[model samples]
Every structure is written in structure tokens, then in C-alpha cells.
Target: MVHTRERSLLPTEEPLSLLRKDGSPVEDSPLTMPDDDVLLELHRRMVVGRRFDTQATALTKQGRLAVYPSSRGQEACEVGSVLAMRAEDWLFPTYRDSVALVTRGVDPAETLTLLQGGWHLGYDPYEHRVGPQCTPLATNTLHAVGFAHAARLKGEDTAALVLLGDGATSEGDTHEALNFAGVWRAPVVFLVQNNGYAISVPLSKQNAAPTLAHKGVGYGVPSVLVDGNDVAAVYAVVREALESGGPTLVEALTYRIEAHTNADDATRYRTSDEVAAWLDRDPVDRIEAYLTSRGLLDPARRSAVAAEAEEFAASVRDKMNVDRTYDPAALFEHVYATPTRHLREQAAALAEELA
Candidate 1:
């Protein structure tokens, strides 16, 4: 007997952008006029995120942190989407989303602690309204869907913004979460930072389909593609989606421009020429140029922002150097609200070994 094989459903590529690479408005783009203040804020946050990435990368090399994921080319996507969120809304971030976490009011010190592996997490999720930085790729999307569903059941008006990468879309959890969010009409934003590669696997190899945004349409969620490097576009799309009060999938077309993580070397898989090409369209430079043209950012103000970022980076470095010892027993304590017998036994055994 012959069996028929099921074909995988994939998303189609969609048209992108409310703004051009040169900050020119795309006539057909859905966004109307861009606010100057919003643009400036986006630019500032991008600079700050870039600075953080740089410092984190250096810290990893110096053995201060276990690992680091550089969001160098994708700062605008994170900062922009973060700026669109309300304080009460929850942010579900991947390990690479340090910028989004910081923009959503997570302390720099807390982020450093998490990155340096001093604790399972540095901040209370309730206090910051940000979920843990999930290291398991696309698993957090389902968590965001559940959180949104719960919020809806509680009659809350807030939404949940879930951040994932292009590679994550390939994960089973990514599709399941999207399906659940759509079926329930959960207030969730599925933000896909399409940085062109999933580790060493380029987007082309990841899927036969053109783009991740199209994945939502079949699930009954509205989707959009945006210039991930253009903070204005990201902010506009995210804000509109949040206001719409339903699931929205946004594929931010950007580039990684760095290694997947500090432990991985890009030189082995990707070429320097590719990195240089993306750097030429650096999101930070684009926003800075726009601000300079509009006189929103003068040299003095720009210098001030740069200096502030430098100081912040220094503070993170200082904090990372501090004593971060934790009780060995505490590890088993937070493993569950109530520990199971096996966990308790393991914890006790570990504690005795340490003692």
C-alpha cells in the first residue's frame, strides 16, 4: 500500500515598508505622517541597544558572561517594537531581545545578571511585566499566547508582544502558538525579526516560502512586512497592530550582521562581504541621518546620547564584576513553586556535594 504525504504549509512573502532606506515615505505604505518625536526616540534607543550589544559581546570575550547574541544590525526592530508597547502589556522576548527588555523598563543590572548566568532571571516577571528571556528559540511564543488568553479571560485590555527570529518560525511551537492565538483571537503580536539567517542556515534554506509574515494569514491573523532597519516602520506597524486588539504577525526584514552568538564565529559560514553590505545600511546610521536632516539631533545632543550609552555600558561591566554567589540549595527552590520529591532529592544531594 502507498501512503500519501502531507505538504507543509508555508508563508508567502509580502510587500514591505512605510519608509525607504533613505527615510523617504513609501507612497503606498499604510502609515501616514511619521511623528518627529517618535522617530527621535527610536533612534536614541537603537543607539543604546547597539551600545549594549557591543559591550555584551566584549564581556563574553573577556569571560565575564557565558554568551552573548549581538543585535547589531537589528536594533531598530527591537527598540521600535518596544516603544510601541504600553507599560502594562507583557513582552515575551528571546535570548537576543535584551534591547526590547531594556526598552520595556527592565534594569540594565538585571539584564547583566541574566546574561552572566548569576540567576535564572534577574527581575521579577510581575514587576517588570516582561517574561523570561527564553533561550529555546520559539517556545516562548506559546507562552505569550497563553498569557494573552489568560489576560483576555481576566477581562484585561492589554496585549502580549512575543518576539522571535526568522529561524524560530521553523519550530513546531511557533506555528502552534500562532494557531492558538488566532483561533482564540488573543491580543498578541507575533514579532519575527527576520535577520536573514538562523545561525548558519540562511533564510533561503530554512523555508521554500518567501517570508514569515504570510504564515499568519492562513491562521486568520493579519500580517505585515516592514523594513526592520527602519525604526519608524517597525514602530508604526507594531502600534497599529496593538491598537487593533488581535493577533498580528510582523516580519521585520533585517540582517544579523554578526555571529548568531558569541560562541559561534560567522567567518566560518558567512562571508565578511555580506556583513559589510548590511553594515552599510546600519539602522543606527539611518535614524541618525534622519534626525540630523530634521535638526532633531544636533552634534551636542548626539554626543550626549553617545556618552550616556558609554556610561551605561561601563556600569554593566562593573556590575558583572561584582560577587554573584548564590546558595546551592536555592537552585532547587525556584525550580517549582512546590518541589517534587525527585527534585528535592537532587537538590539535597547537590547541596551535600557542595557542602
Candidate 2:
């Protein structure tokens, strides 16, 4: 499998960005800064997403959630990428992208359902234009490409935003989907949240490329790299990619401050210093500093946001405390319209045992 063909690492162009680590604006982007309202909304969503992560992680520790993946330092990626899409666009998320679901207006309680070992996806995909979060890596791209290509075939102008981790870029399905997307001119944006790891494996071991986004270059898809922690940068880059009317690949340089999940210990792989460096570049803090410097968010406004976040965390805890109990038999209910003979017998045996 090691055909070491040396393909030129040629990419479409440089990545887009609009913010510095200290929250200063970069004058390079042709696009002007987002308006006050847009900035305000971004800040609000980042705050809410962070609080959601905090509450979900706490629930996992309390045994309320079966498992939880915390998107702590990556709020900007979830909020900015999701917000970049138009009303008609679809979002294909990963299991870790519960925050993306939250950004799209899905209830915190319901969005955490599958993570808490509840029912299948709790939201309606058609209504929200968001597909359920996929647990299998790189498979979501297949769904995104198929859905987007079908939309174009049907003469609909809908685009799809698919989120994946750095590890997913290694999967054959990801490569095939990107290759097909370019050939078919599918209006789908592939966003790789390069959080440095696929569980315990770091990006260095994931694949070899000048950059992960370069993989899409072979397929004739334009590529964009951006600082994933910068909300403004991510939102701007993703906005243009989704609107390009063709496939694009965006590699966001971000870090996952938490473990891969509640069951995995990140300390076994990463260092405290590495985590601290990313914590210094925290997305929520950067925007708050930027807005505060411009007087957009004063002390009173900050207090209001704190109160709102606290209320949200309290509600999530309360809802999870009395959330619906998990039923083992419910798994087979929606799996098939007509149960197989073997499945029917198992169902009957289980029902009889329960009775």
C-alpha cells in the first residue's frame, strides 16, 4: 500500500484569516470585519457553547451521561463554521459536534441524548437541515457529498457543511468523497477541525501532507487554512467556501483542550504545557477581549452573559437529572420497517422476559 508517488504539494491559495492572537484585526483579508451585531452574536454563541461543554463534561463525571466529548477550546470552530452556512445549507456533524447542533438551535438536553445513551438522534434533520452526528470517522463526508450532489442534481442551490477531525482525513472514504465532489462540482464544504488528535493519535501520525487541506488539491477542490480559534477568521473563511458554488476544503488549526471523551485520559498523550498554550489562545476569551477593547461589551454586559451561561448550565444539569430513562428494546424500533424473522423472535423473547 506504500506507493510513494511524489505529487506536488500544490494548494489552491493561502488560507484566510482576520484576527491575531491578541484579538487585533488583520488587514489582509479583502472582506471587511463583520458588523457589530454579527460580532455580538458570535461572542454570545461562543459563550453558550463553552457553557454547554462544561455542563456536559460535568454530567459525564456524575454518571448522568454515558460518554461525552468536550469541545472546550474549539467553540469558535463549532459556532463560526455553523453560522457561516446559509439558511438552506445542511450541516453534517461528528459526535463531538454537539455544540454545532446547539449553535443550530437544537435543545441542549436533546442534543446530548445520544451521548447520554438515549434514543437515536433527537432532532429532525429535514426540519433543521442538519444530519445526525456520525460516530464513525470520515463516513459523514460520504453522506455530505451524496446529499449535496443530489441537491445540485435536483437543481437546488443547497450546500453542505461537513465537520471532521484530523484523523478522518486518513480514511479512504474521505478521499473518495472529496475526489467525487470535485468531479461533480458538488456544493459542499469539508471542514477538518484539526484539533491535533484522533483520540490518542496526534496529527503527525495521522497522515503525511504539506497540510491536511492539501489532500483536496489533487481533486481540484480549493483549499483554505485558518486559525480555528479565531471565530471571525473561521466564519469568514467558511462563509466564502460554502458560497463558492463548488467543493472546498478548510483545515482549521485548532486544539481540543479536553480529552477525546470522558472514557479517554488525555494526560496519557498530551502535556499540561501544550494544553496551557492553547488555553492562552482560548476562543471565548479572545473575542471578549476584542469586544471589550472596542467597548462593545462592558462590565454590565459581561455580567449578563455570565448570568445567562449559569442559567443554561443549571438547566442542562436539571434536565439531565430527570432525563428519560434508556430502554434497551428501543434500539430495534426504528432500525427496520419490517423486522427479520430472527429479529422478531429475539424481540418476542426479550418482551416475554421483561413481562
Q: Each model's TM-score?
A: 0.93, 0.94
Task: List candidate 2 stretches off by more than 4 Å.
Answer: 1-15
In angstroms, how far off is 174's CA in candidate 2? 0.5
Q: What is the lDDT for 249 in model 1?
A: 90
Go through the candidates in order and give each one's C-alpha lDDT: 0.82, 0.86
Candidate 1 per-residue lDDT over residues 203-302, each given as its tens digit: 8888875577867778988877778888877887788777777888988889988788888978988888888888887888877877787788999989
Say which candidate scores most in TM-score: 2
